[model samples]
Target: MNNDSLSAKPHYPILDGLRGVAAIIVVTFHLTEPLGTGHLDILVNHGYLAVDFFFLLSGFVIGYAYDDRWHNMTIGTFFKRRIERLQPMVVLGMVLGAIGFYFTDSTIWPLIHTIPLWKMLLVLLIGCTILPVPLALDIRGWQEMHPLNSVGWSLFFEYIANILYAIGIRKLSKTALGLLVLIAAVALAHLAITSPAGDVSGGWTLNAEQVRVGITRTMYPFFAGLLLSRTAKPTHIKHAFLGCSFLIASVLYMPRIGGTDHVWMNGVYESVCIIIVFPLIVYLGASGVIHTQAERRICKFLGDISYPLYLVHYPLVYFYVAWISNHQGVTLVQAWPSALLILLGGITLAYASLKWYDEPVRKWLRTKLG
Candidate 1:
């Protein structure tokens, strides 16, 4: 690739909008989770796969942005850039989670009152660093590393992927990277099919098993995404944005394929979606263009709020989940208004944080550190 090609980076507006769409679906998934028994019956059945999709998107974007620029970038410089781009929202998400911590008190976590203020503050501090907390220190009873902001676990893995890329993976030849992706894909399939729950969903805690799940989830799609970036040839496609968005939604909203009796069936389905379908969707999104001014504005708005929406929305979800748990018999029909409020509230907070806080922090970081 020439320097000009490297410098004039193409913005995948549709990909950004797709990311925002996935974030919205995730919030809907969490909102509806309390009404279901398990993954099989959840309202948005495959929303958790959004995290995997995110890993893929991150890898592709990173490769596209940095792989060729390595000659001008040191590992330290790359890490700094990644931190500047990502860490601000992470901190903001944790703070929001802390501010709303007490309000989430409910029957599920009866000990919320028993935990002292100092401990909560300490967890918040640790959470800001994106470090995993042990089970002994799990303050929220969910056993999440960042109990206040459960999504931090994914960010933790994101950092890990970045570190790996900086240290060595970025230097690998295409053949070597392809081999690595294949190995990781096999591991992912095994983890998905063999798990007792028949789904690959155990990466929030600090344990051997969960760590395995986390690693398996992170490795395959990320590397596949890296490979896709290296090999993908974008073609002109009409309405690619709409087409790709529909594809993503369809995959995420599909019902469990095999039901409870054949858990591996759903596992295989999830594996195929992550390993094959998501990459195709990303390719389609990246290849497409926003033809009209309205489309461009829509994509821009969604792209702008995508990260903030993903990071900052979950704290409110904790309260929503707690509220639903407290009211046992309330159907989603009765709770639609509150759910709409939470959705709008999350979008509003995310937009405000983007304009007022996150963008300013990032600009300062870029001025000082760039």
Candidate 2:
């Protein structure tokens, strides 16, 4: 979300557009999740990998945007910029989730109404700071750190990755960074292949195993993207955006591989996508050139709404999931209309948040905090 300048490096519109595409896929993934009996049969089976892709994109952008600015930027200033860019949406997303929390009806979340208002408000206040609450604070019975907005879990890890970069990771020699990334890759692979579900998936909770999952998931792609930004030689690729988008869709939409008997097969697939395929997409996206004004406008629109879409879509999904729980026999086919409405409404709401809330608040924050 950083602005372009007369002297700054040119923006990568394709990367922004790709983020929007992945965010949409994430919405679909959530929409279809409750329909499945378990993770093994979800319709958009591999869609959670989008989180890893986002981590890589974030690392690449951070490296590109701030690596050189250390000479001019203090750590406090770096954090201020990040807070200004990210926290407004965080606060709004939590408030939106809180507003919807009491209305959701689900067998899975029987305690929402029973929880006292003060405790829920306490959770909301901590959520605005993006801190993970303990399981005691889990009012939603989902074990989520921020039960108000479950996706805040990923944002918490994103902040950890950012702090590591600013405090130490950015200072490593390329060889040292490469070595650390190699170690993280091995850890990630081990965790994925040996996981109970064999997909490296559980990170929303604040426990030992889940924290390990979150860290392993964050470290490799993030620093690999950092390494790529430092060492990449971007060559002009024809139709990079279109080609990369197809690659992403294929990876994310691939059906769950390896039945219960051969779980590692799915793990192998996920590891390959995260360790190799996603960085390739980021590199190619960095090399892409927009060919026409139409494509540029499309990219701009997608980029502008991607973050808001991601942060704000899930609270509404909470309601949809509750609906599925209440109406037991509704098939995915019968629910298509509601799913479509959720998709369209999410897009509309994200655009509105970006324009009506995010931009103006950010402008005011920059003036006050800059």
Candidate 3:
């Protein structure tokens, strides 16, 4: 690797900024989770869709960055670049989660004290590799692949998507890729529509059904994003950042559709959001132009911290959720101040992690690998 190899094509700044917007929404979504009685009542009702949005963005970015450069970049180089970009924050997120694990003692996770220190450390080690843990080893009793940071489950699948792109799918004809996206879209719709919950939500477990959910969730959005990057003929969209961001918020912040009597309504909503709306937003965001220094700086900061923020915020949410569980009758109004503090603190930590840890570590890694 040399300077030439390290040089990257220009980014869709608005898309990066949108990622940060979605990551913050995800944080708020988790922050408010303990307030809700169930899926239908959550304040940020459709925030889980942000993960699908991220997958779509990942695919589009991947296609833009590597699709045509395969002639020059080896698979090793591609993986190395991805690792340099992603792994530092990931390792720090796991360490932070592990450090906070035992302190979050509440009835919600009563078994926390019973788990041995070595077991927690072992799980942390496995989590660093982005591998799923077995249910039997679930120290937090959450049955999550990465119990310390529940968000790691999505990252696990994200890595799988990356590997698939690097291995063979990137070589597929545009028509073949489009067909794959179509089939995946159908699978995703069926999963959402038929689910008892009537939403595309459960992908943090190791069981067969959850795995199917995870894969189905991963396939359509990510593949559609890839297809979009290849096939979309983006045009100038004035104020695209503002417009696209609003579109994303409007869709993701939507109320849960088809309540207890009709889960399928919500299913259709989620499918339509993922299959249709997200791609359009990405296209618009890609087509956007940034005209001012302030806008550029804002997008840069958001893009820089988006991944770190997404990876690290959940550990804090775990503690917050536990606190909420301990005080069951507390209303969201009573809890708003604390939730706001966590949101601000998560952003600060993500920035600190980026400047002091993520940036430096990535630089060092790139130097060494280069």
Candidate 4:
């Protein structure tokens, strides 16, 4: 099969499949609250770390797919492509979520959950770019307007990354490399601070405040990923070493569940360990030699749907939980049926969005913008 034709050669399936695995992990991780709270299962809860993995994967994929064109493309063209690819489905999700929230009459919800039209528009703008200044819509209080697209926050960084790539960083990816170092330094600093301080108020939850804090901590991991993207392709043995480093560090510095213990140095320990490990994981995954047929399939599939799933899963979970809690007499264990249903429903919605919205937009972009 020749490479030029769309189906002449099968693209990597293993990575696509890995995407499915990642999504499943994230879904399970979120559902863990219903399964059992405070009772930690390392494997399930640890999936929260998948967000880091996604960041790394983003750098590699971006680097792999678009690095060559970076020099030739104008910034306007670059951003236009991004908008066509990312904005359509995201905007759709936001609009759908706004409609859902309004109909549900969440204005009375204590968590300050309500989305007005103006707030929805602001979310669209934020989705278009990750602005330095905060943009707030006073739905219930001062917060970034589109909580529905909370997962969309990462897209902001991806935008920044695209800009960096366009500004001659693609020639040798110096920006990516620099970002790696900067991120590492930050991670180490944060780790050191938190290690002695203990888990700040909330460790890493979906709460608004926790989301704010978590973003700060995630910077290092994201940069670690950028480093891997910048790396020259490695040999199989080198890739193996990188993979091993990730496993070792994760086990050694597994973080504590609750508040930071200033007296105990665990937080610092975990931080240092993760900072080192994150890059290694990126290295291995980006290393073509480490990829397999099955893994690629999973990764790509999940990666394709990941954005939609991440965006809508929260609300779906909330509604599912509420429905079960009220009428079904569903205990957490019994909640499994509802949870599974939510997963299936979300996946279906993601597929519909991808096929109907994401794909059309992407095709249009490639034709007009590319």
Candidate 5:
């Protein structure tokens, strides 16, 4: 698989559609987060795991697209392609977050008024670079590196993974990559099992522990995904998309496995899901093919908007969370309609941004830089 041949390889549509599905689940997860008190009671119990799934998908896709192309693609070229593919939404999400910041004034984040406009602009500028801000500069009080768009933290780690691949990982032999993945798997399991919260969750902060969590979370599945891409042979599989979707939903929706007394049990569950199940799902998705025009269109649409939807939905989520916080007694039943509106609004906004803003920006960049 030389660079030119690999570059011409067709996309795995099922994998793209599955990514969209996970993105939608993340939106629902955030929307429902306020409805419950803890992981056990949350509506979408495993929604946070979508980030891990995303990391795995990204690894596989990157390997498929560029592992061979590295012979011709310089590190500079690789970084530019990634930035062009990803940075537009990052900027838009930050801008949208800043725009919605003041409107999210509620009991939850009451100090929005105290934060100066210049500080907010500064944070937005920093966020545009996908760099994590420290606690000293924390304006939103959530301690998120990108307080405006908290999701940008994942993108920060994502860039790290890309840099690693470009610099050295792409050149490693399968045996060496396997050893790295094994070591990462152990670190991930340790992090998951020992976490105070009994899950692999806190990667958004810029502290030492959270940075470890972010990197640990990134290494295993991402490299596992890369390893899988190099070794696995895709075979004919029936209903692979549906089966993989069901598997993902089952893993995510599974109830908290262990109570506070047996916290490590749940940690093991999360580790196993991330280390073992997620790669299986990606493999299944990549092996499957769309059999109908309807399925193809659906997958195409979902694939097209998945990235925008993931990046853009959270600012609106901030507004919705604040709205719910302001009205304390509202039940999920009472707020279902509003929740539907938020979901629909996110989808509409994502589609519009994709068609109007992201596509044009990328096209222009490609024309100038390609």
Candidate 6:
């Protein structure tokens, strides 16, 4: 088979499983109300780590998919495909949010304060190019954090990295450029919040800005993945050990070293995890670690439904909570079963949507574009 053929040795099925796992983590993380306190919150909110995983995986997958043409891949084809894949869902999400904002009797003020329709339209347009910083600036606050599409910000960065990869750069090596940019980001954070005279602001302002800064800073992990792509080694025992060791040590020692709470720290943790785990995932997928009949069936099913699950689950969770609020005092334990039920229902809807919507659309796009 030609190397560029889509069916030429599918190299990343396990990564699909990884996507399922990440989506599950985000679901679990958001299902609870520990946003303010508890160690569980720390660990659970670590679901944000999945976003980093996604970026790293994105970098790796894009590099793998287009490496043959990395030098000559036309920006037109690159972005055209990205738009086809992304824009439909983004439009759907925006329409949902806009309708919800205007028609729903919840709270119009927050939506209006955070993002008007014009701003959102601009975000949708400019965001198509991977200008996340500008997009981030456009949508501020908890309400506007995800805006019309909660997962849209990361997609924005993924597209940005795609453009950057396609366009190429000059003078500095990609690795050196990535490292310097990472360092500058960290220094900017430190100067912003940290101080020689102690956290004189007592972490109030710092805490407030954490999520936004963290999301943008998450780009470094994607860069790390790009660096890994530039110099990939065949999967090996020693390399896996080193990668795992670095990942564990970084996660463990980072807090002791201070600044683990910084947005940049998330990028560090994500990169380290990718360095450790990605090769293993690639190896397992290639070698068929779960080669058994049942295993393949489950992985394929989960992988197929993963994207839909990611798309549908978020609003459903919050909406479920809203729906159940009037009954009585429902503890997390009580609410969780209903949450799971809702998730399962969402999964069913997702499966149907995949069959009826995503596949047909993808097929039409590929035929038209290819």
Tens-digit per-residue lDDT, 1-370, candidate 2: 2222214787888998898888899999999998999878999999999999999998888888888899989999989888888899999999999999999947879998799999999999999999999999999999999999988988899899989999999999999999999999999989889898989787899999899899999999888988998999888887888998899999999999999999999999999999999999999999998999898898888888888988999999999999989999789999889998999999999999999999999999999997
lDDT to native, each model:
0.87, 0.90, 0.88, 0.52, 0.87, 0.50
Q: Judge candidate 5 at residue 309 and give its lDDT.
A: 92
Q: Please write out the lDDT profile of model 5 over residues 1-370, one tens digit for every residue.
A: 0011133687788887888888888898898889988877788888899899999888888888888776777999988888889888999999999999988988988788799999999999999999998887788888899999989999999889888988999999999999999999999999989988889987899999889899999988788888988988888777887888788888877778788788889899999999999998988898897888898888878888889999999999998889898999789998888889999999999999999999899889989888
| Native RMSD of candidate 2 (Å) | 1.4
Candidate 6, 265: how far from true, in Å?
10
| Best candidate, lDDT | 2
TM-score (all chains, Cα) for each model:
0.97, 0.98, 0.97, 0.70, 0.97, 0.68
Give me the candidate number with maximum TM-score.
2
lDDT of 1 at 368: 92
RMSD of each: 2.6, 1.4, 2.4, 6.1, 2.4, 7.1
Tell me the TM-score of model 4.
0.70
Which pairs of residues clash in candidate 1, taking residues 3 or more apart in a chain or in different chains? none
Lowest lDDT block of 10, candidate 2? 1-10
**Candidate 6 whole-model C-alpha lDDT, 0 to 1:** 0.50
Candidate 4 residue-wise lDDT at 100: 57
Instruction: For residue 232, give model 3's deviation from the true position in Å.
Output: 1.2
* Candidate 3, superposed: residue stretches over 4 Å from native: 1-8
Instruction: Write candidate 6's Cα lDDT for 179-218 as tens digits.
Output: 7547734643453344332111111011345444443444
